[model samples]
Target: MKNKIPNKIHIIGSVGSGKTTLARELSSMLNVPFYELDNVVWKRHEGHEDIRRTEKEREEYLNTLISSNTWIVEGVHNEEWVSNSFLNAELIIFLDINYSVRTYRIIRRFLLQKLRLEKSNYNPTLKIFFKMFKWNRYFEEVGKPNFFKKFGDYDDKLLVVTNKKELENYFT
Candidate 1:
């Protein structure tokens, strides 16, 4: 169990921004529970359309973790709706890795998924492809503002980790 101080941690980034990778690493480093928002957003089910139906359900699940004293949550959702997690988090790490880096990672992830024929609840279509591109662009444009709004200028509770070396240094 995590103590009250620094118990809650949140990570924000685009797809393939290494959010989960860093979260898992931090969980081991800090000895705290790590919660992937993807898992919370979609309940695993056998060919069920309703499995990932409601944002409300996802929000509720997150609320449960926020109520707890210790948790590290990672996802690429809007900062507005997900503010509660950050509000509780003693630290918030945003991975602002270069667009090329994230693009490479996403492409690699796609290839691996295709090779394994893995069944993911999330969309793996061209729509998602464009979405990923748009997300990367938004990170530079729209997303940065929200990030700053929630975790920067007004707040000093955020850490922006842009490269593997920076991440390593922070965790080390």
Candidate 2:
């Protein structure tokens, strides 16, 4: 089936679910700027310290992006703090790939980042790698369900993709 995606899109998914990759592709294809929630949430001012932005700051920043006519916002964040983006988005894409596939991607991405074969927003270390796996598990068990429940009201605008092929088909 052919789908007409909107310019204002919000992509939500668990870690390693290809949210970033999809966001980048969509941004290029649609010629719209994309923002990663992680960057807006965490600020590494100096070294490895993750200084989180205040709720007001994040809201202001997000408001600025949303004020634009077209944009793509992607991240794993599903908290109330980010509800504005969801509300403002014309479409919400959820990458609901299988746990096994996500796990494999996580490991592969970690290795690539560690080897400097891939660029990452944060430092690639054993600690962060292990944390990713843990986060993945938590997401699969808890976050995914919570997202469904919380965003159920937006089902009409939500597009759930369970595999790469399905996502490619939708985009095509």
Candidate 3:
């Protein structure tokens, strides 16, 4: 499976499903650059509020990355704007872990971030933590079904991993 992985890989999954972790691992193993869609969407500025990039800017940034020879892009976003990334990807990994596991990870991540043990892209707050749970629920109820309906055509290149064990086995 590792040998079968292509140069251009895109990973999409529900929140706390380890998209970033897997992308970083694969990027290191495959020696490909990795991109986080959140970073592209939210522009982080020191001592100032983070701002979202304009639609055109986001599209251009994504296009530039996708045009590269080899790269790994990971995010929970599976929107129409990001369809080009899906189309251009040689391989797409979808993490479909169970809700219980995902929720646990979400809480664990929040605790770690709050304790300063783990770094987060955004500030960790009580409101944001609860919102994560809601997002997880929304993804499970709505996002997953939509993803299946939309990207089912890409089954040839799509790999659905249901748990951490499967994910580990795939890269072994």
On residues 115-151, what C-alpha lDDT tens digit does candidate 3 reach at each position? Answer: 9999887888899999999999999989889888998
Clashing residue pairs found in predicted model 1: none
- Count clashing residue pairs per candidate: 0, 0, 0
Assess every candidate by TM-score. Answer: 0.82, 0.93, 0.94
Q: Which is superior by lDDT, 1 or 2?
A: 2
Q: How should the candidates be ordered by lDDT, best one leading?
A: 3, 2, 1
Q: After TM-score superposition, what is the CA distance of residue 163 in candidate 3 from its true location, in Å?
A: 2.0
Worst 10-residue lDDT window, candidate 2: 42-51
Write down the TM-score for model 2. Answer: 0.93
Q: Candidate 3: lDDT of 45?
A: 84
Pairs of colliding residues, candidate 2: none
State the lDDT of candidate 2 residue by residue for 34-90, as single tens digits.
Answer: 999998887766565778899888878888888888999999989887888999899
Query: Over the stretch 1-172, how does candidate 1's per-residue lDDT look in tens digits?
Result: 3323357889888877998888888789778899888787778765555367387777788898888877899988754557788777888888888888888987787776667665455656667767877778777788877777756742566778888887666555
lDDT of 3: 0.89
lDDT of each: 0.76, 0.89, 0.89
